[model samples]
Target chain A: MESLYLAWRYLVYHRFKTLLLVLSLTLLFFVPVGLRVLVQQTALELQRRAATTPLLVGAKGSSLDLVLSGLYFEGTRPEPLKGAEIERVQDSGLALAIPLHLGFEAQHHPIVGSTVEYLDFRALEIEVGRRFVFLGECVLGAAAAKELGLAPGSTLVSSPQNLFDLAGVYPLEMQVVGVLAPKGTPDDRAIFVDLKTAWVIEGLGHGHQDLSKDDAAAGVLKRKGSQITANASVREFQRITDENRDSFHFHGDRSAFPVTAILALPHDAKSKALLMGRFQSKDETSQIVVPSKILDQLMGTVFTVQDYIVAAVVLVGLSTLATAFLVFLLSWRLRRGEIETMVRIGASKGRIRALLLWELAFVLSLSVLLAAVLLLLTASQGGALLRHLLLT
Target chain B: MIRIQDLSYRYPEGGFRLLLPELDVARGEAVALIGPSGSGKTTLLRLISGILLPEAGRIHVGDQDVSSLSESERRAFRVAGIGLVFQEFELVEYLSILDNVLLPFRLHGRLRLRDADRERAAGTLQDLSLGDKMDRRPAHLSQGERQRVAIARALVTEAPLILADEPTGNLDPQTKGQVVELLRTKAGEAGATLLMVTHDHALLDLFGRVLEFGEEEGATTLVDREGAQ
Candidate 1:
């Protein structure tokens, strides 16, 4: 006990040296453990979301990009599949098709245009107001709502694809009707609207003033027996409301409209295999992908990279530990006079050894405790941090 | 308090030897030893305090046979029965003056530290005019004050014998005299036998007798206060 007391006093007297040693040891212990915990948590989060999503159908291109864009609403927007694919999947009776129209942004948040079934498929519940019920209405994810500081009755304007293109996609103002509850997933960072609204934002659908009205006669370019054509002076309705909602219409064949992907949920194993086999033909323009399989490949690469990182951290930790040992040894050398003094004063050999050992034990114990606390923080919050990193 | 008969010691490297025929000091005697450098004045103090064992003969301090005791036993005896004061003070710089004084009790398992021991240490520093400086480290003290702290450490043990080797060697002339006088007074007040080695002849008057070592053959001659050898 007395030896411990002396050791404590020695450490307290040289507090700066003690603090430096402790911080070095803390990093040495914390880095590898914290890295492992974060990687494991990221893997688990990715796997959980991917496991819940049965399959993804999109244009014939990068399966990984399609999965990432369809599931996470992140990364490159894949080549789009036609809206007719949803009808084909529905007619097959092998799966339920949920169409996704992606590739638009509102306030930097991805605008995910899907049917109401998409929300039910993902088990998303509204936290405020109600879901989008009109063509120009949007529902914000919890994170998006908090980020844009918008609630029900607030307005959000879609960002124009190109600021300088006068005839390009125009910014359409949409009304915020609801906010979704947070699920700690990518869904929490997206803005959801009806599929037609996304097409409207893409300049594929629009509303315009009625050229048949008597007040708009000068703007009409030509008039046939039962049809009329208007020039550029005609005003296009940028917002859809009760009075102008009926004016919003699509110009082309509706079945040919583009959707980024379709989430296919089959009834059983046979149904899933049949649906997967249907797109296996080389002549098929679209590909069907199992999300879990793609995610498994992704996690495999992540684990390999994590292994290298952990190895590097261990090597660095070993060197740091060696340096810490050298520091303690040099410190012991500097304290030779003090040790000699203690010896001459009748301090026993056992007591002297105990004093040194106790000091080392104190430093080690403190480093371990601090490292544990940091690892706990990483374990608890690492998923959310990883999600934010992957999304942005 | 100390007895040596026909004692002989030689350094292992072989240049010097100490041969003492006979020596005796009564309990409570304050004696001074003077010699030239390497004349074995400090060596004799080490021999009597059991810090060094003679090559030939026996040494007795109080009732214990110091030269015959084993190494561990000798260390226990040294910590419990002899108070040592060194020229450099040798106080642990990290410890305060009071902890330095209380150090002996903490070193050996035989001595259990108590509240009374703390009070006695405090009192010893108080008597040395260091009551207010108990919490100060040795580095913060002047040379005389540091030496006094060493003296307080030696006195706090309440040992039967006090062996000081040039306790004032590093002090100024005025501080040297004052330190020697304080050591003598403290040893007398505690009833401890004082055997101090010094090269300073002026302070010999403070002791009952002075033994001066001869440079030729390590022989010693006793000189009383009248300067008669």
Candidate 2:
């Protein structure tokens, strides 16, 4: 009790020095802990998303890119899979297949072209309004809705990926149908649309005039006062409602159209093995990748760098700890007179050492508390921090 | 009561040494040790308080052979049997004057803090004309006030022997006279054998006996005079 009182007095009397020591020690401990927590948490987050998605089938290049693009809705457009591939998976009875086409953005957020099965697979629930019922309607993810400040009945114009490719694609105006509730996932950052709406945005489907049928019987007539030519403007429906729903159609066999990737959910282990075998044909232009394994390998590369970085941080932390220890030693020398005084006043040598040790314990305990608070704050924002740092 | 026989001390790192053949102070006696700067006046007080162990001697404060005690035992013995008033008034500057006065009880550890202990501290401060200055730290007190606080600390525990080293060495004339009178009266009232080293000739009149140490090599030449003014 006497040691405690004396130590408290010293700390309070030299408060400025105590504060400096606490701040330095807190950062020294926090950096290594924060780095370790961030890496482990990021790996867990990425692995969770990847684990749910068993396999991704996409263009025959960077399997990591395919998985990242298909599962995470990130990266530039890879060579797209066809609607026929999705059909083949469905016909094979091997798995549930959801298609994703992401080569566009709206307000700097990814616009995902997928099927209604995508919503079911992700377990997304609408927080407001209804799901898309027309070709040009899109639903906003929770973060997207909040960031764009859009709700049901609002208009969202898809941002064309390439301005110079205006002939092939243009900014298509989409009708906001609903907003998804916050899921704290990557899905929260995307705008989801039906595959047909994605095709309209890609200029592969549209409402246009039948040039050969300038016949009055078909309701094709020249504007009475305006000049008309063989090339009549094909009216691309900017907004889709019940009236213009029939006008939007793909020009060719829609089954042959493009999709970014096919997310395959194999029914059983046997079917997964069988499906893996089927995609192994040498003539195949696509490859099947297990998303979890791909993400693990991707994280392995990151971990190598992280290991070196953590080692460096550990070295710095150790240096700081050594400096603090040295400071403690110096302070002990400085307080020799005080120690001698206490001893002369009938305090045992053990009591003097205990008093100093109690002071140390108090400071270190405070530093540990600071480190814990910092770690929790970082953990709470781990997803957003990782998204900002790596995903974009 | 205190007794020393063939007491000798040598500094381990230096060549300073002092050997006294014999010295004795009876119970309830007030003795003043007067000496030149290097005559071991303060050293004898430290030896009596067990702050320094004699190389070859037996020094007893009451019945205990303090010279034979271990380092820690000596500390306990000092806390239980001896009170020290240092020349420099070694008060912990961070603590309030009351805490400084009660320092012996705090470090003793066997003594529990009580209202009575606080009252004793207040009473000691009151005797020293510092009743209202309990909350002020040493840095806030005047030199004479700090000396009184140091005296209060040494006396608060009511130890049997009180050894003071130049207790009034730094005080002005009027404060020195008042401080020595208080020390003499209190030690007599408590019946604690008092031994103080003083350079002030005027204060020596208050002591019952005076022993003077001259500038001599390795010797505490006793020049004793008994007549308490």
Candidate 3:
């Protein structure tokens, strides 16, 4: 007890060193724990979003890219699926498909133009105003609402598809019609619009009215019979509409308009499994991904390296602690006269040793506790920031 | 009683050697060891307390021959049977006077001197005229007061042998007389054998015997014994 008591006293005496040691060990502990929490929160967000949509089908490529671009709204511009492909799924009685036309951006945030079902699938309930019903109208995620400071009537001009695209691509101005409630996931950062709007922004489709020469000559064609047609033109041209949309023109058939991907939801597991198998074996340029399984694989690879790094850091921390202890032992030898004085007073060596060990244990235990508390605080706060950064 | 026979010690640094053919002290005897700084007074004290072993020789304290004991055994013997008052008053600076005095009892096993032990330490400090300062740490105590606390600690366990290094070397004349008198009185009442090493020649008459260190040459009477003052 005396020896331990002495150790304890010595550690207490050197309060600064104890603090430094605790800090070093805390950093050693913090990284792994913090990363783990981030990973957990991210995976949870991904899984929650994935569950809402039963299936994600994209142009044949990395399944991970499909999930990232389709579900998480991340990754590069994947080749678009023909509008006919989505029609194929919709024509089939087995599944319901929602077309997602991505591959565009406005101010570094991706512009996701899809059917109303995308919002329904995400379960993003409106907190204020109405949903997008007209061309150029937008529904903002909670994060987008806060970040862009856009509300019911706020107007946002579309920036280039690529965030770093300084050359300025389609910079079309769009109106924000609604803001969705926070989903604690990536749904907060997305800009939702009608699929046609995405196509128009990509210069792949345009809004049109059939022109009559005689009616144009009569100067009343605007009020006469002019069939509204969906225009598909890959090339840029001029535009003319009630909205005075643009001068960019695309030359392509409306029926063959391109879509980035499709989200399918089957009624049961059998249908889902069958749909997934078909996509896997299909000759069409498409692949299906289960977000949950992909996440597990991702985490597996991540954790392997993370575990190794944490183990090495902890080993180094422990070794430094051991060296600190050795310094203590060596110092004890230098203080033999002082120790002898204690022994001569009837203090047993055991007591002295106990005091020494107690000192170190107290400091280490305190440091670990402080680091844990800090981790908790950071997880709670930093988690919010991460959701905003990675999710909608 | 304390006894040493054919004790010879060599410094690891190859300094002067210490050789004693015979040395003895009976119970309640007060002896003074006078020597210059490097004459091995502290080394002899350390040897007697079993802190250091004589290169070759024997050191017997009562019925136990310390030179024959193991390192751990010697530590136990030193804690239980000998009281050492260091010249520097090497008190564990963090502990209060009361805890310092009670330290030996805490160190040696089977000697549970908790509340009662503290009470005994209080009494010893009172006898050393330091009762009021029991709760104070050594840093707060003056030089004379610190020395008394060290002495009080040595006497707290009521051990049979008291070895002091330069007990009054730093005290004023009046305090030096008082300290030496206290040591003699405590040794007599406790039936303890006291060996004090000092350079102060004024205290020669206070002890029953004295042993001078070093060999004499033509100009220097290097080893001249002077009884207690």
> Of models 2 and 3, which has the larger lDDT?
2
Query: Which candidate, 1 or 2, has the higher lDDT?
Result: 1
Interface RMSD of 3: 3.3
Ranking by TM-score: 1, 2, 3
Candidate 1, residues B102-202, lDDT tens digits: the string is: 98887777778899999999998998899999998899999999999999888888998999999999999999999998998889998999999998888
Tell me, what's the RMSD of every candidate?
3.9, 5.7, 8.5
lDDT of 1 by residue, A242-334 (tens): 889999999989899999999999999999999999999979999999999998898898889889999999999999999999998998898
Model 2, A53-153: lDDT tens per residue? Answer: 88888979888778778877776567888789988877889988888888889988898999888898889999999887678889999999999999998
The sequence of per-residue lDDT tens digits that candidate 3 reaches over residues A1-392 is 55555566666666787777778767766766776786677656666766666777777777766777787777666777788878777776557899888777666677899988888877889999989887777899998889888899888877765668755455567788899999876668789988877777776655333233333333332343455223232222233234444433456776588787888877788878877777766565767777777766765775686689778877886787687667667767876877666655545567666655677678668878988987887677776665445533
Each model's DockQ score: 0.56, 0.52, 0.31
Better DockQ candidate (1, 3): 1
Say which docking band candidate 1 falls in.
medium
Supply candidate 3's per-residue lDDT for B223: 49
Residue A392 in model 1: shift from native, Å?
Answer: 5.8
Worst 10 residues of 3 chain B by lDDT: B215-224
Ranking according to DockQ, highest score first = 1, 2, 3
What are the clashing pairs of model 1? none
